[model samples]
Target chain A: MQFTCAKEDLLTAIGTVNRAASKMQKTILECILFSCGETGITLRATDIALSIKTEMNAQVEQTGDAAIPAKLLYEIIGRFPESDVTFKSVGENSMEISCLNSKVVLQQMDADEFPIFPALEDKEQIKLPQCVLRTMINQTLFAAAVNEDKPILTGLLFDIEPGSLTVVALDGYRMAVRRQAAISDIARKCVIPSRTLREVSRIISDTEENVKISISGNMALFEAGNTEIYTRLLEGEYINYKNLLPADCATSVKVETNMLKDSLERASILAREGNNNVVKFEISEKNLEITSNSEMGNIDEQIPVITEGKDLVIAFNAKYVLDVLKNVEESEVLMQYNTGVSPCVVKQENSDAYEYLILPVQLREE
Target chain B: MQFTCAKEDLLTAIGTVNRAASKMQKTILECILFSCGETGITLRATDIALSIKTEMNAQVEQTGDAAIPAKLLYEIIGRFPESDVTFKSVGENSMEISCLNSKVVLQQMDADEFPIFPALEDKEQIKLPQCVLRTMINQTLFAAAVNEDKPILTGLLFDIEPGSLTVVALDGYRMAVRRQAAISDIARKCVIPSRTLREVSRIISDTEENVKISISGNMALFEAGNTEIYTRLLEGEYINYKNLLPADCATSVKVETNMLKDSLERASILAREGNNNVVKFEISEKNLEITSNSEMGNIDEQIPVITEGKDLVIAFNAKYVLDVLKNVEESEVLMQYNTGVSPCVVKQENSDAYEYLILPVQLREE
Candidate 1:
């Protein structure tokens, strides 16, 4: 499209939609369409599953459109001198980008060849504060299954009710949940891929503005400030994680989060050398003992804590315990579990806003 | 080793010898030997061809020694709590590292199994400022061939005369040399692998002290501050690079180093898309036109300059020009060439400290 914009403006616009650009080889679909008109310049990219559209104000001399290779244009523009950059539609399927004393003629695909983006209906739109959404995504996305063997496990379930919202993600080994108050009157639930939520969190870092959420059919849309991201919602029922959490425990201990995390991390040094990577936790009055043994070495460390009920000992994958402890913001975390066989419950002290469940690893009999 | 030292002190010593630790699997040689005496604690690691030894002050509880996995010990020391860290020779093939409330039992190999580093003779030694040696290494190392097809091409030749020292590296395509006046009486020459020089530069950053150089047989030692690096000299004589450089050229032009570099980098964007990555330069009067054409696109950009002799057009790999220009510290660079087929010479104004020779690519007959 024929448009003149500041080097920084176009660069920012390109970055906003760059994540959705498909990296698939040998297809025109791996391009970002630039549409310039009275509404400035609109940039759109889609990889079928994920799509993003962003707009920037530009001085449009002629109304036109051009589909340019996303990554190539980004690198070219990143190296161009800062000032007013001019983009002009030139000889068939080519565009000229001129800035300062340099001009780049980039080969482009036909704009008409770009696939049409879906227009989601705004039936029941929900708005959430960017900071809250950002925190929830970061806190829960890590627990999602990285492998696509179970598609539902790769997504975070967003359960929104009249006055509350709970975000949950679970792999077979562990689960992470974050709860926050909601202002929306409507009740709806959606399973959004963790990848989509990750992209949302990154965009949230750009601004503090609230994100407007809307959905139509099986697609979910998130509009954060000037950028909008669309992701296909996962079908099928998500696993019922609430029922999986242990409701009763024979023992519970309040330990400093940082201290516990450090002990686990140290134990991991030896545990990681072994495939099992299991760290044993033995609790008594006023202290918790963390230990690990592997071919490389063994670790035995004690951390001060306040224990309630009967003392107990448990063992778990060092990585699983470290993950939850590292995420806990408070100084103390309440760990609850029933004997060594039950899953352990880890939560911030005096607050139910966040919870992490880690299954205990069976310690080999000596 | 039975010694107690601050966490940071032991950490820094480990870092100094880290590069020499062998990465090959299933070898007890992939460890660092900790030798303690009335003097201090010395840590040493050798990968057969390269070795580093560093000493740090510590409280010698008892004079003893142990060999621990280099990387694992470094990580353990890095994560240890801040305080005096104690190391003790414990059970057979194991050591206990304790600090604050934590203790690590690391499996170790016998210190006797670690190879003894060579004690270089003091015959005809040379000393140069660390900054000077660092600069010389960085300026010429990039021209060395990465592949060992012709092992000699991967080493930098260090030639020393009465008061002059020259460092040169060539990989057939290009050559880089740095010549400086010597501060020592001894005159000797050696060919050092680029990998060794790179490690020496890294250690130089840790201290501004001058480096003492000593060579014995096939081994060269570089002692900077408390750290010493020993490298096996590349055997079988280095090439005579002085005779390869042309003494005279038909044309020489003065151009701003930054201006020429920027032009080359931009042209590289398109040139890199082609098989040859060649950028053509046409110089006439005070103008230098840089152009490149590839399957993806083409670039035609002009940068102003001061030219002399016949008007000329030459093509060369844009990467080579960019490499030398990026290394040049002066504002202006002298570009000399005899003809389109001859090698081009790039040098800083009024200095023999550095010289770069880049062979031109034969321009494709349009």
Candidate 2:
């Protein structure tokens, strides 16, 4: 294979695909497959479960393929000055890369050893603006279960209807849900591994460009610009999160987002020193009192809020409350509480575009 | 004890003195002594070996002292909004910190338990612009030994004369020397621990204001602005690095510092894959060819240069060469070399303010 391209184009393509390259020891999966054709050069890397492919324009002298170690190639290409870089097959087992005054000959793995990108047939497709998808992922991905004890919980649930899409992620203590208007050809619900969504989020631009998403059987594909990511769906039914959200509450309070977030963050500092990051909130007629205590210290913070119905006291792991508050962009949010031990629901004052449910920790009788 | 100060003032004082707070388990040294006086509040912390003291203005209602955990106080003060924060001792064992509508009661250790700062008597003092001292430290600190096997090498040598000050740091492979002219009452030499220098560097401003440094017996004190740092000197005779630099050379090359640095960095990427990061340089009449090969790959890079005297070939650990290149601020530097196995010297073209000596690796005969 022989080709020449702008250094930036190659570097971007390499960076995008290299995220999926396997880091396991002694495996050909550590290589990125470089395929050159008459039109462009395509770079692909995979770790069996997740695969990424990207294409960039290059002047082709001959069409060929080479599988090169992803990290080595990235380091070398990243250091080259702004210039055109050329790659040519030196032999069956090696490739020569030259840019300006620098030249490198790197050994290549057999291209046939690379795992082929899985094919998805008769897939249902949906389209959404990239920025909308980016926001939805950011708001929910943090709530996903980080441990693999239950594999399905480690994936985000993507529920699509004809005219809207809702993404949900939950650990045992809290659930995050985000909804946006998106058109879909067919209704589908799939649990995509959170790792894949994270990679997709990093690759996609936060612009108004549309990202094409397709799902079939046990596979999902995300295509943005010149890059495509393929990931295997977690093969298990997601929890019935819709039924878990509390529909009614005994009390409700409206508070400014930033004020509440700041108070909770300060209270969290001392709470974190305890075994459980527990912070208590006392809701009353004109203010919300947040308090937390550890072996070393205790904190008390008060922020103005408008409350309706009966006053109540509740406690929760400060991290869960802080996470939801950080993602809420609205000026104020309405928090509905049922009791001290039941889950509390937080929503935007004007719209239901985003919702968060957090289970309160049982406060020790005091 | 009671005092009120701007949150920023207290936070800055805590950050400056907290660097000396000990991190060892179950120790009172982890606390910073907060001494309130009629005029201001003085914060001091010590780990027996190094101590730091800083003072900030505050309104003192009553004069007393409290020893609070450095990290906890920092976190609390940093999170407070821009307002006056008040600290009042709640009892003999705790203090109440309040700002705006928030209040925290933090447990405190007895102020008497904190280590006292060491006293230095009959000290010789010298003063230099903070920016000059900052630059000199930056240029030579990287060459200091990180291991404690030779404790003196882990410290930087400060050699002072009536009108000149030279700082030297070496870890056997390379030595960095920086010299500047200043007026001093007494000529003295001392080895200040690198850790102390690093903290001093961080706390001092990069401005034209003077920094007063005093040395006596085995103690050195650095006073910059409102902060004062005291450190015990590393006890041992420093190696005579003056004899290590070659007096004359058989060849000399003048090259652009940035160009050489970039080429070396790129070549080092491949060279690093080998055991020793070995890169060979073949200097001819017009160009310098750098080459390195590992089990996985090989790279060859060439850059133009003006060579004087005999043409030569040499090999070195790329890291040492890169370190010197990264520190030199000159547009062009002259590299003086003897035989391939001898030490090479790099210096600014116009002055002897900075000097770097790097020993070349013995290349195996091919």
Instruction: Highest DockQ: give the candidate number.
Output: 2
| Model 1 pairs whose backbones collide | none
Report, for every candidate in turn, its global Cα lDDT versus the true structure. 0.85, 0.91
Worst 10 residues of 1 chain A by lDDT: A203-212
User: Judged by DockQ cut-offs, is candidate 2 incorrect, acceptable, medium or high?
Assistant: high
What does candidate 2 score on TM? 0.98
Interface RMS for model 2: 1.1
Candidate 2 lDDT by residue in tens digits, B157-218: 99998888899999989999999987686788889999999998899998989899999888
Show where candidate 1 strays beyond 4 Å: B206-208
Q: Which ranges in model 2 have alpha carbons more than 4 Å from their true place?
A: none
Chain B alone, model 1: TM-score? 0.96
Give the worst 10-residue stretch by lDDT in candidate 1 chain B. B205-214
Local accuracy of candidate 1 as per-residue lDDT tens digits, A1-366: 588999999999998898888887446677889988886988999998889999899999899888888887887788777789999888787788887667778888878888889788755677778998898888888899999999999999998877778999999999998998866787988899887898888877534567877877899999887888999999999988789877787888999888888778888888888547888999998999988887778778989989888888789998888888777678888999888888998987777899899888887787
